[model samples]
Target: MTNRALVIQDNHHQTFDNDAFMQARNLKAEYCNSGTDALHAIKSHRYRCILVSMDMQKENPVEIIGALRHAENTSGLSPTPIIVAGKDFKLTQSDIGRLNISAQIRSHHLK
Candidate 1:
């Protein structure tokens, strides 16, 4: 497993303070402020985990997940595990099946 992680968020403030957690675990963390930038980073780097915030301002979180899936499929890369973060995300069953979300981290649980 890579000792790296990618966090996709519209803002720099991470709900879980993931950077510090990663540091404590001796892992490297990278942050992307946009979905496009996140996709580029995913293609170029290897991450042990991908954490995406559902409360983005510019792009829809579902679309970002779709784009990431498409990129992986087109490039013949193994599926990268993804975790979603939100305080009030309510994805339908179809949406969850489509994205294959591995897990969710609530905003409150971060603390």
Candidate 2:
């Protein structure tokens, strides 16, 4: 597994301190402020994990996850673990299963 992570967030709407999470995990992160940037990064590199902020005003986190999953399928890449980070996300268990999300980290749960 790689020691890097892909962190996608809209700085204006970020609900959690992603840097602290990454630091605590001892993993370096490549930050993407937009879904477009995130897609490009996923195409070029494999990350140990992906942490996507669910509070983005410009992009829907579910759609972003779908796109990322699609990219992985099309490129024949292995599924990367994806953790949704936010507070009170409305996703149902079915949605999470369909998206193959690895985990959910509530904003208040993170240091």
Each model's lDDT comes to 0.83, 0.90
Runs in model 2 lying further than 4 Å from the true structure: none
Which pairs of residues collide in model 2?
none
User: TM-score for each prediction?
Assistant: 0.89, 0.94
Taking the tens digit of each residue's C-alpha lDDT, what string does model 2 give over 53-93?
98887889899999999999999998999999997788899
Candidate 1 accuracy as lDDT? 0.83
Error of 2 at 109 (Å): 0.7
Q: Write the per-residue lDDT of candidate 1 for residues 1-111, one digit (tens) a residue.
A: 788888888877655666655677677878888889988998898888888888787889899999998999999988788888877788888988888888887887655
TM-score of 1: 0.89
Clashing pairs in 1: none
When summed lDDT is taken over every stretch of 10 residues in candidate 2, the lowest stretch is 10-19
